[model samples]
Target: MNKAITEGLLLMPPAFSNGLDQWSSQDGTVGSDTYDGAVNAAFVAADQDFGGCLELLKSETTQKLRAMVQTPLHPGCYLQIKARVKAISGNLPNVEIAGWAGGAGDVHVLDVVEAGPSVALTSYGEVVEVSAIVGTGARNGVDMPWGQDALYGHFGLNLTGANGGVVRIDDIQITDVTNVFLRDMMDWVDVRDYGAIGDGVTDNAAAFNAADAAANGRQVLVPEGVYALASNVTFESPVRFQGQVTAPKEVRLSLTKNFDFGSYVDAFGGDEVLALEKAIQALFNFTDHESLDLQGRRIELTRPIDVQDVVNNISTYAIRRVIRNGQFNVLADPAWDTDVVTSTASYSASTSTELTNVANIANIQPGSLVEGNGVGREVYVKSVNVGAQTLTLSQPLFGAASNQSYTFSRFKYALDFSGFSGLDKFVLDDIEFQCNGISSGILLAPEGLIFHVRDCFITKPKDRGITSHGRGCQGMLVDRCQFISNEQPMRAQDRTTIAMNVNANDTKMRDNRVMLFAAFGVWAGTGHLFSGNHWFHGDGETDGVRRAGVIFTTPNPKSTVVGNYIDNNFIEMTNEHDATPDWNNQYSFGGITITGNIFTVNDVAPWFSWIVVKPYGSGHYLHGFNLSGNVFRALNGNIERIERVDETYAGLDMSKSRNVVVQGNAFNSVDTPIFNPLMVRHTEAANATTWEIPTDGKLPFGGRARRVEGFVMDQQVLRGSNTAHYEFPYVSLQQGADQSEAHLKWSQACRGRVQITLRMDNAT
Candidate 1:
């Protein structure tokens, strides 16, 4: 797919002979270069042989071969230049590539190590396709910084760098390479004379207004230059602020005010970059598009501050690399008031004295009226209120029939996004957001709109870093974003992290790197597709930082979590209830299509208790669940741990959960595949008695204690083992599994009550 659109000057001369004697002298020049009928003379040194030099001074000779082509190559067209080098002497010499356009500062070079030895006279030709420089200062994907004159072109085999080897170069040719195959994929427009609004001269405000005039229809180009700013600017165009240098180097975009990083100190002392501060606010709010793209521009914050927190200001991670001045610091504000209210239910003393509690229930909403039909089946406000931190669901009550258990099954919701119509697209490519607090990073109201965040880096967001509950927010895609945590700076309190916390349908999160934070890396809602994401834990919390690869509560119809890597998360972390629900539910939140994912851990096994397949409610049908093609590599054993307190563990729990298939996985070092045990906890309420039965009486007796005198009771038998029963199938290996073991394990878990299926393949 090589398309040649334009023709530029081509100047590469040809050479004859075999060794150094023919190329050492400047007087000996060859005239055989061609480019679209244009040709140039290739000069050579004399007294050098065509093929004999051995043990020659290579470094000194190469330093003299630096030659500059007088004419510049056109950037609008793709060009391929070929130079022929022959092994006229000893061995082959190394090659270096570099390009420069107009300005002295705008120059780029790519060093590639080619694999080739000496070539005899019979084998004397090889063509290499060098990759062109991208972004700014590049024309048609190639580096053409020499401008129209192209006088600064320099090319030659640096024989000086070679230790003692020598080679003769002949017949050098340069031409416009054609890419006719990909005419559709590439579009080339003549932008050589395009006008720029603000060449660092006009008002910054006016520049932004003109740039974003078309919203998502235009891509404003930022040429190489220094753009001084009196005020901040914003860009809403589909523009790319390509830079010639890294941040704070050649170009600078100075700010006027100070940015607050909460506890995280600022790089500049007390002083803040006012322009950047406004930009930070805009990025988080996703509103006010004033001054975001600072291409190749250095930004000087008014003051220097320290940055310790990494979870609150996820943008700080990108800003960190931009710091080039005095005492670069970080500043962040804390989120002391961010939480959610869950659902709860109660029962009458006589109707249902034995009541159980379930954390993080889904099928219920807030402030709703419910109906009932009989004595033991009534629907009240099925929720417990917890302060300002509350989450309101769409529905609360379930079936209120007397003949059967009431269960609220599937609850579907779509997040809304209002107030954001002027904005069309939100593209965050190659950007970084690092949080610096103990709270969430991004908290959207019930109506946040369309978003496309790609190639962005986010780190350590205090609570749930990014969560969405808004409306009109369709086509939400997060791809190639890096999510990590930093515990060194802000040690006061750890903000449990969830890279992407969204409750939306038709959502897609793909190819993201989620490192260890506080808790679950990705806690999603329903109707979402999570594919090819990498999740890992660096720290060894009895449970590693990530609690779940993808956590969702409600029943989702078409949600799929495929081709993800979830390993080493929630490792070594104890499952003892620090709170009611331990943090070991790394993959607790479920109701998803878990397929083709790799789960590896050393200790804290994957949670398969009430959390794994917990039901929606009493009579609701929870189906369409599939757990296939997932690989689990364990260093220690125990891949699954399930502890159920009640025999009737709801319609949502795995007992009643259907259509869950676990096959085509890999497991190592893990002793058992699954473990489930019944646990009984003491009542936390007041004194109550319903049924009293004599344990020692031989016959029917009431309120009478009978003692067995001849029986011997062992202390070990009375006090059961602390661990649960280890049963069920183990994870499958990728290479292939034994048919017998696979069948045996498969039958044990899903014989009849549930249909368990198995296939031996190397798909993981």
Candidate 2:
């Protein structure tokens, strides 16, 4: 909006053709004009086609030709002067229309830009328009510096510098243009009033600040135009934007009173991307408010926004930042796509951090998720040295190997927090991330504390949802959240992405729903509580074959997976990465309690078990584990044992794994009828050397007997004739094929019946 001030009533007479009422001669006399200050300069009612004219005759350089305008003056007024002049006859005079400035009263003697081209009359019979901007700033201008007693400007035709000539000046006009600069009498301050040009060329930052400074508890109004704010401008007061502003993101603009996205929408000409970017930046900086409430605006993002890098990589920040109550729609822009690269690296058993001689090392970005054979879950690149062909990982990979090829997938998140290491207390609450089957959800801070994601919906994340690649998840909490993958419609075995990945310890995941990715979650850390979650991962698998619901990618014996409803999913307790069962005093797969869970499946696979312990290396055993009060039911056919070692490898080292618990579980349509320890009796004939006893495969792990008590009795005669004679048989145990049946050998031939008692106890 062109807020240029409107002119008031004419300062001159209503008509210059009627008579020179306010006009005067050079000697300051009204109705008296002199030729060369001595002879005829007169007002003509009609001269040729002109409506009115001030006819003047100029002959000498000392001759002041016409009268100056007499008008009322004000302190903060802009006096605009204009006239149409022409050099009519005789020697062409260097004549022009000019103005004079005065103080306190209308008394004369101040020439303001008299020689300026704006008021020059050069051609004969050709109307040359002349004008001047006069205000309290100068004799002619816009900015009004008040506090003066009074100021006035006088306009007239000048011939003092001209040779002998005749000049005709007509249509002299003047008006008070003070409304453009007047703000003290109004309720708001306009940016135009502070000399702001909205042509998109001039920097209005200073003018914007000036208007805000003069607001005086009133709203500062930015009228409609494209204004460039070349510098950082902060509006500390209430501001209304009918216009838009442009500035680089490097500038910090704090709209303290209106910090929400709605205000930015108005400020950025309704560009949602620009609006959201600034709003989030303001949120992280804690401008005005610590939390940026988007007010449920659906923002469309065409690119990834680096949360911490936009703030210049502070590396250490403790302010609580929150972004809530909105949804971000990811556009199908190639710049927002994930980066995937296959690289070869050399590893060592000494340290898993140095992945050297890496191919495509320069293409691997920092914070990229590392995956492949022997790579640990949730491992990411902390830094990369392309020249040295090495990548410093956030943590060690799972297994030890050399010259291995790995895939580095760097997923672009809607909000990336990978730049800072100590940005603690971050929150994303009550929001939705719509990845559109292309982008990911969120990348967490590298090393922060108390990162909480609650009451949010992560929809269609292409790679993973809510990743913790560093120690930022030390005490992370994900509560009442839902992760819906884009590949959720695919079968469990065909799904590729995971809903989440955890690395740091002491994290709690409660009451969250996962839409069944290939792996629901990749867990590494210990001391976690995962409860009240229903993670179903079964689809079109008639054979009842699927991946593990939760993969213990590392040794975690302190975590509890309890009270969950798992569908067609099993728990995988493995040391596939680091095969040391008791490395660094951390017991492998032991001390974990899986209780009070309901496991249900529809298809049939006789070998499909509910719990599988996979120990890749020798001597790796399950030192301690618990499985109690669980209900396992198969719909189609019978399954194998409820808990067993992976059939592909040798069973667990039973001598080292003595504290295994498998009891109090109700099963339906499963192969094993019961799992309680069983006892049996075997009768021996006369002179028999061996007595075979059948054990009902009721051992805790289907392998070895924990304890056995037995005694031999006389079977043939019912009573021995020599009762005092030694007739007891020496005990020799022979384990059966499946290790369920027990065989006993006798040192001497004796007819007897042997009663055996076997038991395995791990209730503690």
Candidate 3:
């Protein structure tokens, strides 16, 4: 392109009126006739239609003229090169308008001998127009006879015949007609302008970026083909996608025009699951958006969506990320089925963490729950050794002995975050998980900080609601959520799935509701605040069966269970982590505060207590246990007591447990006339010689009476004890400290109703 003429800013070669400046003939040393590859070349006058013309006298037929246009041809543009030519004298020769492709610095790349149809000059002094359409590429009706590179295109003329005559050529023209075939001229740039191939084999990274940079502020068009981008691509301008692109998962993409999932839905033609997967993958890898908004679309998945994978570039992300406003429904796919392994395993009391098995250990998942006869609750297989045929457990078994059949159940979650180890400040807000009775709600990361789940509904999960496999629940806040399990209509005793599982510490559960599960929440963590919750799993049956509403891994947990509506459920405290407290410090074991909670039973069992201490070993006792400000009511039968050690274990050692406060609780027709500090009243028989009464198994927490203080005065003493006006009764404590019974001997068996205070001793 020599000079511009404004036809799409078409650049033109110089006219012969300028005396052939920038035009040259091929030197004659090789294939041409003379030193200038011509016998003679002179600028001269021509017909009036042409201002002037160049006359070249070809001594030999191989002589030719060449003119190099330094400007590069636009990609996908076809240029028509034409010239008027006629033979002056001698035999007529055919002249062809040929062009050579150049790369850089006018360097010759490849030449095409026949750019267009060759025209033979038949008559002397007769004007004939010869034309050819040469294109930068072979697309858009331009065949391979004319193909131009990105840098330069040199237009030339060739004459053939042994006795070629003098020829005068004039009115040379080069016109850009790219838009005539590819598209109309517009304010946008096509990626093909920068040598982008749509064949799906060539990497389009460099070409795409060049087009984007050339667009400046204009829109970029990715025209139809499959383009492979081997590296990450960033676009600061708007882009229109008419083709698909493929890249590795580690390659991040920034489409500034449209970054929402709706746009992807449009891109993939309404395939929502694939759109969601792509959107989430973009969310984690790129810096464009910190949160992924599902826009209230219900995406159904046939398999679990693993959050952490090799596709993501970042492993430890402390930035706050949010995924909100979407409902995930599970479909019936066998991929949702969790792995389960059943095998015969033998456990030894001496080796609590190792289980010897003779089965397919390769099928056992490392994090599967280990359940068998004598298997402790909340025990999981930490690791599996296929060579040794042994399973390492997260916690030791309780009383595992001999060869027992064990079941290792691996849990599959709808949204699995168990792959990330250092993910923090991630929030899951306003999401509904419809598990469809096949999968669990969410599986948390193994190690993270402050994973918040709020305003969520986990409904009808087959296994668990929100489970923490490791220290992922550290500082986790679950607020304004509901966890209802698939055991909704099952009896409390028959239900097996738990609503929630907390494996880490410092979890704050606030304003949550739970319904119909074997256990409302079984947690091992400390510093938990369970407030404003209503947990019930009764199923309204008359069997009087109940489930544990609040269960702790350690009996002396430092937590507060307050303002909860507990119906037909009991609280169980245990030490499933270790059989004894020797492995832990005293500070790790703490007291419990169960106050301001409502405990009620509809058709209660005759042996149900509001709270029970279940320790695996005898060394741990209740410390700072407070059962106050709670109301226990029964509809059909009376509850035995407010609190008791598990009936399967021995009686509570009152001398070892201390700081017991069980008061301010109102019992309705149950635990009638309950008084704190272990008290009983009796009216002596008329004219009795001696009196002895047994107060065994009637006191709460298995209190053993230390001493009997007062004999209540009757009839006129203003119902006072230890302010008696009549003779005082002599009382003595019996069955001391080991059994919960008191023996009293009144003074000479007086015929008066006496009330004595049986002061129970407490351990320091």
- Candidate 2 local lDDT, 1-764, one digit each (tens): 11123445336523455455445555433334533333556776776645667777775574453344445444335565566677778666554445444555445444334332434455678877666555533312442322132354445655655566777777666655666556457777777655465678778777777767867678888888878888878887788889887778766566887788888888888998887777766666657787887889999988888876676526777877788888899889998777899988898766656788888888998779888876656678877899998887776755646777899989888888887766688888899999888788888777888888999999998888877767777778888998887886687777777788777787888898887777678777678888888887777767856778887766444888899888777788766546333345456457688889998877857877777777655555555576778899987877866667773534565544446666688888777744434455666545455666666655656645544554545344222342332545544443566545555555554456667765443333
Candidate 1 lDDT over 631-666, as tens digits, reads: 666554454432222223243222222333344444
Ten contiguous residues with the weakest lDDT in model 1:
697-706
Once model 3 is optimally superposed onto the true structure by TM-score, how far is the C-alpha of residue 561 displaced, in angstroms?
A: 1.2
Q: What does candidate 3's lDDT look like per residue over 407-489, in tens digits? A: 88988888877667567888999999999898988877767899999999999888888876666778899999988788777
Clashing pairs in 2: 35-39, 133-140, 133-141, 134-139, 134-140, 376-398, 398-577, 590-624
Worst 10 residues of 3 by lDDT: 27-36
The count of residue-pair clashes in candidate 3 stands at: 1
Evaluate residue 109 in candidate 2 and report its C-alpha lDDT on the 0 to 100 scale.
Answer: 40
Give the TM-score comparing model 3 with the true structure, all chains together.
0.79
Error of model 1, residue 5, in angstroms: 49
Estimate the lDDT of model 3: 0.69
Instruction: Give the lDDT of residue 393 in candidate 1.
Output: 33
Q: Rate the local accuracy (lDDT) of all candidates.
A: 0.34, 0.68, 0.69
Candidate 1: Cα lDDT at 643: 20
Root-mean-square deviation of each candidate, in angstroms? 26.2, 8.9, 5.7
